[model samples]
Structure formats: C-alpha cells, structure tokens
Target: MTFTLATWNINSVRLREELVCKLMTEEAPDVICLQECKSPVEKIPVERFQALGYTHMVARGQKGYNGVAILSRLPITDAGGRDFVQMGHARHVAARLDNGVTIHNFYIPAGGDEPDREVNEKFGQKLDFLTEMRDLFHADKPQRSILVGDLNIAPREDDVWDHKKLLKVVSHTPIEVEHLVETQGAGGWVDVTRADIPDGRLYSWWSYRAKEWDEADKGRRLDHIWATSDIASAGHGSRVLRAARGWTQPSDHAPVFATFDL
Candidate 1:
C-alpha cells in the first residue's frame, strides 16, 4: 500500500481551519503533521476535521504559541508529547500508526533574526533543542519512523533562494545548518524531499513581510519530511504545494508532502 504524509505550518488552526479542510479534500494525504497550531487542544476545531473524514488526532498545543499536531485517517497509538526541558510550550508531538510506522512532528525555535547566540536567547535555545533531539532519537534509532514539520532550518544551499546572500540569516546560517546536520546524522534520517529533487532551489516557506513573496521568490525550505534509513527506500515521490502559499489569507509556509510505498 502507498501512504502519503504531509507537513504544514498552518500558523493558527482556528483561523485557518477552512483552509486545512480545503487542503485535506484536495490533496488527501493519509497523515498530516502540522506545526504552530496556536490553539489549545479543545480549540483545534476537531469536529470540523472529523466531519471531513479525519478521525484520529494527536496534538500538543498552547494558547497562542508554539504547537504541533498529527491528524491521521488511520488509527494512531502511543501518542505522546515531548516536554523538551519543561519549556512550557507544545513543540513536539508523536504517535504510532496502526501500520507500525511512527511519526514525529516538531516546530523548532525560529532562532530570531539576530543569529547570534549571545544576542538572541532563542538562537541558543534552538541549538540546545537540536542537541536534545539528536541525543533523544539517536539512543533508539527508530527503523520504521518518519519525522515531519517546520524544522526552521534549511540544510542545503539550494534549499534557500539565495544561500550566499542569506548566509548570515538565522535559518540558513552555518551554525543552524550544522546543528540540523548533526541531528540528521545522529538519527540517520534521510531527507525525503532530497530523495527526489536532489539539486535545485526548493523552498517551502516565505516571509510575510514581502509585498509579493511569489514575485520576490525569496524563500527558505524550513519544512521537511524525514524517514529512517531502513524505510527511506520506500520514499518515492515528494512535492511542495507552492501555489497554496498564494491562497487568500494564507499562512507564510506551504505544505510539503512525500509518498511512501510501504
């Protein structure tokens, strides 16, 4: 059977529930991992999504801050949320599907604009978060696992619009990239997107600060889908729904998807 999984940072669930439903009906991913939900679990508008045929959900959310959720049509078990140093934010949520595949959704810190750890505390926290993640996952090294969400780091030069110009930028900086690489190496996680578009300018996120983000085309591939090496071979087609970024009242990021022939 072929299963499709998607990752998207909706920014806020209550505000974009309609758009989420629209995407669900249009794309029909078997599982959708979301980040930055910005709403409590009860306020996530679950009924609307359930009405659309998604009956299973595992989410960790705050009032209006960092949050992550997994919405699946298939049954999900072992639902758990990571505290990550008691940070008091809903940043990580994971579940195991009946197919025996585990899914982890994360919303790593944005690391602020400063890019300097001393100046920006968020940057320091972001690096520490990556370190913690590396340590946690490397211990077990899951085989039938998939990780997805807005990781907030662009690992390759081509993953950004202009790598040279954005070298100083937080998302594309050397330090951030190194941290992400370390995490990937620790977990032996193969980037599903890279399995297809090996070399090219691929981006999943655009800053809302732009007057015309599409015209500017200044974007960063902050979102990602990763699979354990054991099941990485199952990864086939991967795509980014770039046009969705232009939808009315759209979020700054678009949906990234990958299909696995399990």
Candidate 2:
C-alpha cells in the first residue's frame, strides 16, 4: 500500500478548523497528524472532518492546552498514547494502519524562553520527555513505523534560517539538539524529509512574530516526519506546504508531507 502522510502543528483545531478543511479539500493527504490541537477530543469538530472523508481518528486532547490527533481517510485503529515525563499534557497519540504500520504523533513541550533547566521548569520537562522517548525506542527498536509531529527541536544547521544566530534560541539550542539526535539514534529512525530534500535551508515554522514572515524568512524546521529504518527507503515526495503559513488566520507552522510505499 502507498499512502501520503502530513504532520502539522495546527495551534488550535477549533480556531483553525477551516484551514484543516481547506487542506483536506485541496491536498488530500491519506493521513494527517496534528499537534497542539488545544481542544478536548470530543470538541475536535470531527463531524467537519468526517464530512471531508477523514472518518478515522485517534486522539489525546485537553481543554485549552496541548493535544495530538491523527485523522485519516484510510482505516486506522487507536494504538494508544504515552504521557512522557508524566507531564499530564495531551501530547502523544498513536494509531496502526491496516498494513501493520504504526504512526506516532507527538507535540513536544516548547521548553520556555530560557534554555536552562535550572531556571526553567518547562525546559527540564522537555529534556525529560526526550530522554523517555530515547529509552522507549531503544528498548523496542521500532520497525515499519513512522513518527511525525512538531518535535519542537531543529537538530540540523540548515533546518533554521541562521543557525549561528539561533544557536542559543530555544528550538535551536545545542542541548536540545543533542537530546533530539539521541532520541533519533535510539529508534534508528530515518528523517524522511531530509532524506528526500537534502542540502537546503528548509523550514516548517515561521513565527507569527515576524511582521512580514515571508520576506523576513526567519523560520525553524520544528515539524518532522520519521520512519523506522526497515521501511525508510520506501518514503519519498517529502515537502513543506509553505504557502499554508499565509492562509487566513493561519497557524505559525506549516504542514510537512511524505509519501510511503509499503
């Protein structure tokens, strides 16, 4: 089976429900994993999505806060979720496709303004979350699985607009990068986006803070798509829907896409 998947941090599902519908109506990815849904699972406006043919959903959500959800046109069964670091945030959710492929969607904590864990509690939680993720993947050694979402860390130099300038920044900090790299190594996961579009300044998130986000072009590759080594080679057509950032009442993050043939 061949399926196209997309990962996006929608910021708030209810706030940007129209944007979701627009994406479904236009691009029509087989599966869409959304992070930062910021609504209870029951209030995700599933009827709107179901009307668009994305009838299958597995989600973990909270009121006015972090949430993760997987919506698909293809059949999918809820594979469960995890409360990494016991943060009590609705941050992770998983589903299994009919082809025996599991999809993990995560909305990692944004590790506040200060990168120092000593000064920032959120920073500590973020590190702990990554550590738990690393340990989990190392023990299980995932196979034929894909992980996608706003991981909240841009590990590579080219993943940000100006790597040097952003090194001390939250998403581009060295310690965060190291933790993210360790987690990826643990799972032996392949970055499908980088694999397909190597050697470029690619970004999936442009801060709403920018007055003219497009011309200023200050962005980070916070959103990611990863597949276990076993089926990594089958992933292709990776791209960022950059224009979505300009949509009406848009989310700061854009959708990242990859197609896998299994």
Candidate 3:
C-alpha cells in the first residue's frame, strides 16, 4: 500500500478551518497530522474535513492551547495519547492505520523566549517533555511507527536559516537540539524529510513577526516527519508546501509531506 502523510502546526484549527480544507482539497494527503489546534476536540469542526474524505480522526485537544490531531482518509483507530511533562496539556495523540502503521502526533512546548530553564518555567517544561519522550522510547522501542508534529526544535545546523546567529535562540540552542536528537536516537527514528531532501537550508516555519516572511527568508525547520528505522526506507518524496504559508491569514507554518510505499 502507498500512502502520503503531512504535518503542520495549524496554530488554531478553528480559525484556519478554511485553510485546512483548502489543503485537503489541493494536496489530498492520505493522512495529515495537525498541532496547536487551540480548540476542544468536540469543537474541531471535523465535519468539513470528514466531508473531504478524512473520515477518521484521533485527537487530544484543550480549550485554547496545545492540541494535536490526526485526520486520515484511510481508516484509523485511536492508539493512545500522552500529557508529557505532566503539564496537563493536550500535546500528543496516536492512531493506528488499518495497514498496521502507527502514527504519533505531538506538539512539543515551544520553550519560550528564554533558553535558560532556571529563568523560564516553560523552557524547563520543554526540556522535561523531551526527556520523557526519550525515556519512553527507550523503555518501549517502536516499529512500523511514524512520528510527526511541530517538535519545536531545529536539530540540524542547516535546519535554521542562519545556524550560528540562531544558536542562542530558544529553538536552535544547543541544549534543546541535544534533547531532540537524544529522543530521536532513543526511538531509532529516521528523519524521513532529511533522508529524502538530504541537503539544503530547509524550513517549515517562518515567524509571523517577519514583515515579509518570504523575502526575509528567516525560518526554521520546527516541524518534522520521522519513521522507525525498520520502515525508514519505505519513506520518500519529502517536501514542504511553502506556498501554504502565504495563504490568507495562514498559520506561521507550512505543511511538510512525505510519501511512503509500504
């Protein structure tokens, strides 16, 4: 079976309902994972998405904060979810496809402006969340699993527009990058996006603060698509739909996509 999957930090799914549907209508990914939904699951406006053939959904949502959801055209069953760091946030969810592939959707904390945990509680929470993920993967290794979401950290130097200039920034800081790499290693996950693209300054998110996000081109690869090494080779054709960021009242992030022939 062949399926295509995409991940995006939708910011507020309710506010961007039209954009979501637009993506579904244009891209038609077999499955799409969304983060930062900022709405209760019941209020997710899934009817429209369902109408687009995304009849299956597995989500964890909160009132106006961190939330994650996986919408699939193919049948899927809820596997589970987690509240990493015990922050009481709806940050994670999982679903199992009929083809036996498991998909994990996560919205890791953005860590705040300050990189120092001692000075910022949010930064500390982000670190703790990543630690828990690493430990969890170590305890229970995953296979035939694909993990996607706005992981919040840009691990590779090339992931940021200017790695050296952003090294001190919260997302590109060495410490945060280390934590993310550790988690990926623990899970034996292959970065499917990088594996396919291989090189270049790739980015999935551009700050809304930018006067002209495209011309300035200051961005980071905060979102990711990862698969367990066992199925890594099956993944290919990874790309970011950069045009989505230019959509009307668009999310700061563009969707990242990968196709897998299983």
Candidate 4:
C-alpha cells in the first residue's frame, strides 16, 4: 500500500475548518494528522470533514487548549494514546491503518520562554514529556510505525533561520536538542523529511510575530515526521506546504508531507 500523509498544527480546527477542507480538496493526502485542535472531541465538527470524505477519525481533545486528531480516508482503528509527564493534556493520539501501520500524532508541550527548568515549570514539563517519550519508545520498541506532529524542538542547527541566535531560544536550546535526540534514538526512528531533503535550511513553522513572515523568513523546523528504521527507506516525497501559511487567517504552521510505499 502507498499513502501520502501530512501533519499540521491547525491552531484551532473549528476556526480553520475551511483551511482543513481546502487542504483536503487541494492536496488530498490519504491521511492527515492534526495537532492543537483546541476543541472538545464532540465539538470538532466532524460532519464538515466527513462531508469532505475524511470519515475516519481518532481524536483526543480538550476545551480550549491542546488536542490531537487523525483523519483518514483510509480505514483505521483507534490505537490509543498517552498522557506524558502526567500533564493530563490532549497532546497525543494514535491509530492503526488497515495495512498495519500505526501512526502517532503528537502536540508536544512548548517549553515556555525561559530555558531554565528552575525558573520555568513549562520547561520542566517539556523535558519530562520528552523523557517519557524516550522511555516509552525504548520499552515498546516500535516497528512499522510513524510519528508525526509539532514536536516543539528544532534539533538541527540548520533547522533554525539563525542557529547562533536561536541557540539560547526555547526551541533550539541545547538541552531540548539533546532530549529530542535521545527520544529518536530510543525509538530507533528515522527522520523522513531530513532523509528526503538532506541539505537545506528547511522550516515548517514561521512565527505569526513576524510583520511580513515571508519577507523576514524567520522560521523553525519544529514539526516533524519519523518512521521506524525498518520502513524508513520506503518514505519519500517529503515537503513542507509553506504557501499554506499565507492562506486567509492561516495558522503559524504549514503542513508537512511524506509519501510512503509499503
């Protein structure tokens, strides 16, 4: 089976339902994993998506905060989720496709402005969340699985517009990078996007703070897609839909895509 998958942080699905439908109409990926849905599962407005042919969905949501959902045209069964760091946030969900591929959609906690855990509790939570992820993946030893979402960390120097300037920043701090590396190692996961586009200043998220985001071009590769090593080679056609950021009332994030032949 071959499928195209996309991961995006829609910010708020209800507010951006039109954008979601537009992507479904335009890009038509076989499956899309969404983060930061910001609505209860019951209030997700599934009918709108179902009308667009994405009838299958597995979602974990909250009232006005973090949420994650997987919408698929292809059949999938709920594979469950986790409450990492015991934060009790709707930050993760998983589903298994008919072909036995398990997809995990995540919305990792964004460590606050300060990098020091002593000064910032959110930073501590973020580190703890990554630790839980590393522990879980190491214990379970995932295979034929893909993990996608706004991981909230940019591990590579090139993943940031100005690496030196961002080194002290929350997303690109050395500690966060180390945690992410350990998590990837624990899962034995391969970064599908980097594998496909090995050399470049790639980014999937541009801050809305920029007055002219496109012209300023300050961005970070906080979103990611990863596959277990066994099937990593089958992944290709990786891309970030940057133009979507310019859409009407767009989210700061742009969808990241990867196609797989399994």
Candidate 5:
C-alpha cells in the first residue's frame, strides 16, 4: 500500500478550519496529522472535515490550548498518546493504518524567547520533554512507524535562514539541537525530509512577526517527518507547502508532506 501523509501545526484548528478544508480539497493527502489544535476533541469541527472526505480521526485535545489530531481518508485505529515530562499537555497522539504503519504525532514545547533554562521554566520543560522522548524510544525501539509533527527544534544549520544569527534563538540553539539529535538517534529514525531533499535552505515555518515573510524569508524548518529504519527506504516525495504560510490569516507554520510505499 502507498499513501501520502502531511503534518501541520494548524495553530488553532477551529480558527483555521477553512484553511484546513482548503488544503484537503487542494492537496488531498491520504492522512493529515495536526498539532496545536487548541480545541477540545469534541469541538474540532469534524463535520466540516468529513465533508471534505476526511472521515476518520484520532485525537488528544484541551479546551483552549495544546492539541494533536490525525485526520484520515484511509481507515486508522487509535494508537494512544503520551504526556512526556508529565506536563499534561495535549502534545502527542498516534494512529495505526491497516498497512501496519503507525503514525506518531507530536507538538514539542517551543522553549520560549530565552534559551537559558535557569531563567525560563518553559525552556526547562522543553528540555525535560525531549529527554523523556529519547528515553522512551531508546527503551522500546520503533518499527514500521513514521513520526511527524511540529517538533519545534531546527537541528541543521541549513534548516534556518541565518544559522549564525539564530544559534542563540530558541529553535536553533545548540543544546536544543543536541537533544533533538539524541531523540532521533534513540529511535533509529531517518529524517525523511532531508533524506529526499538533501540540500538547500528548506523551511516550513516563517515567523508571523516578519513584515513580509516570504520576501524576508527568515524562516526555520521547525516541523519534521521521520521513519524507522524498517520502512525508511520506502519514504519519499518530501516537500513543504510554503504558499500556505501566505494564505489569509495563516498559521506561522506550513504543512510538511511525505509519501510511503509499504
């Protein structure tokens, strides 16, 4: 079986429900994993998405904060979620397709303006969350699985527009990058995005603060897609829907996509 999958930090699924429908109508990926939905599971506007043919969903949500959801045209079974660092945030969820492929969706903490954990409690939480992720995957080891979401860390120099300028910035800091590398290594996950498009300055997130985001192009590859070694070879066609970031009332992040043949 072959399927195309997309991961997006929708920011607020209810507020941008129309944009979600727009992408569903236009791109039509088989599955879409969403982060930061900011709505309780019952209020995700499922009827609207179902009208666009995304009939199956598995999600974890909070009333007006963090949330994660997977909407699919292909059938999938809920695979549960984990609250890393015991933050009790709706940051992770998983689903399994009939093809025996499990998809894990996550919304890692964005650390905060300051990178120093001593002064920023959120920064400390971010580091702790990542550490737990590394330990979980290290103990169990994933197989036939794909992990995707707004991981909130840009691990490569090329992933940011100005690597030197952003090194002190939250997402591109060396400590955060090291933590992300450890998490990926623990799972033996291959970064499907870089594996396919190995060069150039690729970005999925352009800050809303930019006066003209595209023209300024000060962006970072904060979102990601990764697959375990068992099916990493089957993953291909990685790309980011950059234009979506320019849409009316858009999310700072755009959708990242990949296809898998298994």
Candidate 6:
C-alpha cells in the first residue's frame, strides 16, 4: 500500500481551518499529523474536517495550548502511550492504521527564549524531554514507525538561511543540535525529508518576526519527518510547502510531506 502523510504546525487550528480545508482539497494526503492545534479536543471543529472526508481522528489537546492531532481517511486506532519523559502537556499522540503503519505525532517543547536551562525552566524541560525520548527509543526501538512534528530545531547549517548568524540562537544552539542527533540516532530513524532534498537548503519554518521574511528568507528546519530504516526506501516525494507561508493569514510554519510505499 502506498500512502502520503503530511505534518504541519498550524499555530492555531481554529484560525486556520480554512487553510486546512484547502490542503485537504489540494494535497489530499492519506494522513495529516498536526501540532500546536491550540484547542481542546471537543472544540477542534472535527466536523469541518469530517466533511472533507477525514472522518477519523485522535488528538491530545488542552485549552489554548500545545496540542497534537492526527486525521486520516483510513481506519486508525489511537495508540496512546505515557509521554513519561515529557508528561503534563498535550504534546503527543500516536495512531496505528489498518495498513500496519504507526504514526507518532508530536509538538516538542519550544524551549523558551534563553537557551540556558539554569535561567529558563522551559529550557530544562525541553532537554529533559529530549533525554526521555532518547531513552525510550533505545529501550523499545520503535519499528515500522514514522515520526513527524514541529521539532523546533534546525540541526543542519544548511537548514537555516543564515547559518552563521544563527549559531547562538536557541534553535541552532550546539547543545540542542547534539540532543536532537542523539535522540533520533537512538531511535535508528532515517530523515526522510533530508534524504529527498539532500543538497539545497530546505526549511519548514520562517519567523513571523521578520520585516521581510520572504525577502530575507531567514528560516529554520523546525519541522521534520522520520521513518525507521526498515522501510526507509519507501519514503519519497518529500517536500516542504513553502508557498503556504505566503498565504493570507498564514502560519509561520509550512507543512512537510512524504509518501511511503509500504
């Protein structure tokens, strides 16, 4: 079976429901994993999505905060788990499709302004979250799994428009890069998006802070799609929908896509 999956940080789903509907009509991915939904499960406007043929969904949500949701046209079972390392937030959810593919959706903490854990408690929590995920992946070793989300880090120098300038920035800080590498390595996951766009710079997020974000084009690879090596070859057609950033009332981030021939 071949299916396409997309991951996006919608910022606030309520504010972008029209964009979501547009994506459904245009891209028509089999499964759509979203982060930062910023709404409770009951208030997610599921009927709007349901009308678009994504009749199934599994979401972990809180009022006006971090939320993760998965909507699929295919049959899916909520594969819930204790986000033990990063509990107390609506930041993770998983679903198993009838095709035997497990999709892990996440919205990892956006470790506050200061990168120093000593100064910022959120920074400490972010590090702890990464550490916990690393330990869990090593212990259980997720198989036949595809993980996707707004990871909030740009690990590679090429991923940013101004890599040299962003060295001290939170997302590109050396410590955060090291942790991201360590965690994903422990999971034995393949960077599906990078595998497809190997040479040129690719990014899924541009700051809304920029005076001319598109003109200046200072962006980060905050979002990602990864797969276990077992079916790595099946992942292709990877793309970062950058044009969406130009849309009226757009999210600071764009969606990333990948297709799997499983």
TM-score of each: 0.98, 0.99, 0.99, 0.99, 0.99, 0.98
Model 1 lowest lDDT segment of ten: 78-87
Go through the candidates in order and give each one's C-alpha lDDT.
0.91, 0.96, 0.96, 0.96, 0.96, 0.91
lDDT of 1 by residue, 1-262 (tens): 6789999999998999988998999998989999999999989999999988889999998999988899988788756878875678799999998778889999999988899989888899899999999998789677798999999999898998888999998899998899899899989999989997898899999999996999999999999999999999999789999998998899999999999988
Writing each residue's lDDT as its tens digit, candidate 4 over 136-241 gives 9989999999999999998998999999999999999999999999999999999999999999899999998896999999999999999999999999999999
Instruction: Choose 5 or 6, whichever is better by TM-score.
Output: 5
Model 5, span 103-136: residue lDDT tens: 9999999998999999999999999999999999
Q: How many residue pairs clash (N, CA or C atoms closer than 3 angstroms) in each of the candidate models, in the order given? A: 0, 0, 0, 0, 0, 0
Superposition TM-score, candidate 3 onto the true structure: 0.99
Q: Which residue ranges in model 3 land beyond 4 Å of their true spot?
A: none
Go through the candidates in order and give the C-alpha RMSD of each one to the true structure.
0.9, 0.5, 0.6, 0.5, 0.6, 1.0
Model 4's alpha-carbon lDDT is 0.96
Residue pairs in steric clash, candidate 6?
Answer: none
**Lowest lDDT 10-mer window, candidate 6?**
81-90
Residue-level lDDT of model 3, residues 60-100, one tens digit each, is: 98999989999999999999998788889999999999889
Q: How far in Å is the alpha carbon of 124 misplaced in model 3?
A: 0.6
- The collision pairs in model 5 are none
TM-score of 2: 0.99
lDDT of 2: 0.96
